[model samples]
Target: MIKNAIYLLFSFFIIGCVSTKSTLKNVDYKATKPKIEKGKYVITEYANDPKYGYNKEYPINIGFANLHSEEYFVKLFFNGLTNPEGDIFSYEKIETCCPFPSNHNKMGVGLLHKYRVTFNNGTTKDLYINLYEKGEILCPNGFKILAN
Candidate 1:
């Protein structure tokens, strides 16, 4: 009887600690609807909220002109973490302000990128990135809001 009681207690404790990781797969970001900024860059949650003391690294894909080769092909992957408040965020991906070449689609477009990010509640957010250049780069904020 004592052994059974102990087992029951242990099982209950373990169940309480069990939790699920953050997976953006099948997550309806569209339903949530991202907040677009001035018809430019769009900001949205990474699925997992990494606020407070909890933090996780997310990966990003960067493509640009290879200055060395004088060609337009470059790829980089890196991990970045979220801020404490969850409002502020940063990634290892390179943020470029320069103009993309005319033939950027040949290299920069149609790339499937993946990143494993952790959230505030010990959950992980898997990010898939798809990059491209739109129109004639209107202004500094011409990047435009990327629709999911």
Candidate 2:
């Protein structure tokens, strides 16, 4: 019984890491603040202004080569991000949907999203919105927001 129970738990954890349609879709975005091109990423900034806040504090996300795809490529740009001056920007994984919370130990879903990135010259920041099929511009020139 103990071995069976442990196996069940492990299976659930593995399943939970796969993000499905509903999980990655449907994030709310602000109309006033639009997506912009900053460094090698096109991202939507977390509106810091109180009037446009999401009532949540999260890091600005950046996107690599997989910004405009429906399939989760699970890869990053080999040549990391750089600036107009050729300085390489650095990033830290601030958050991860790592060990996802399950619903009744079934129907598990989660995604690895959210990050903190600092651009050269320290000019702009924002996060990569991973909701697919919405025509978000590919990083480097494409950024978009959740439609109203």
Candidate 3:
């Protein structure tokens, strides 16, 4: 039908807009996976740069290459973090944006996930995550790693 043709054309246009070179600044293929304890990642370091997860160009790259489910790793990352006051936080996946090149996917492109994190005091922050690339897992500057 004409509608299906139009939809296909639109899809191609959108895919054509994706940049061939990724803008991500913190992808580390050699980064090792973190230890999981009690269903959470045991993150031991804090990000030195404030933009680590807040900026779309520097997403928290929890690669899916070796993992079976993306949400599993995402949950582990958030469960390993807490507010600065040492209180557990809650998060929700708000959106998916920022497509970039990646060899991990059949399409050779990947999208970034945006999460809204809420603390016990009602404070909130947005974090960008890339499940297609790997990086050193660390707590973002404004947050703290959950105590073991």
Estimate candidate 2's alpha-carbon lDDT, on a 0 to 1 scale. Answer: 0.35
Better of 1 and 3 by TM-score: 3
lDDT of 2 at 43: 33
What is candidate 1's lDDT per residue for 1-148, written digit by digit as tens?
A: 9999998886556444433332212222223222334332243324333221121122122223234421111112111223343332222222322222223443221222333344445544444332322111110111112333
> What local lDDT score does residue 35 receive in model 3, on the 0 to 100 scale?
99
Clashes of 3: 0
TM-score for all models, in order of appearance:
0.25, 0.34, 0.90
lDDT of 3 by residue, 1-148 (tens): 9999998896677579788888999999999989999999999999999899999989998997443587788999999988998988889999988889888887677889999999888889999988999999889989989999
Candidate 2: RMSD to truth? 9.8
Give the CA lDDT, 0 to 100, for residue 96 in model 3.
Answer: 82
TM-score of 3: 0.90
Residue 147, model 1: Cα distance from true site in angstroms: 20
Q: What are the candidates' C-alpha RMSDs?
A: 18.6, 9.8, 2.3
Per-prediction tally of clashes: 6, 4, 0
Per-residue alpha-carbon lDDT of candidate 2 for residues 34-93, written as tens digits (9 for 90 to 100): 233331222333233332111122212222223344122322320223454556565554
lDDT for model 1, please.
Answer: 0.29
Best-fitting candidate, scored by TM-score:
3
Candidate 1 is scored at a TM of 0.25
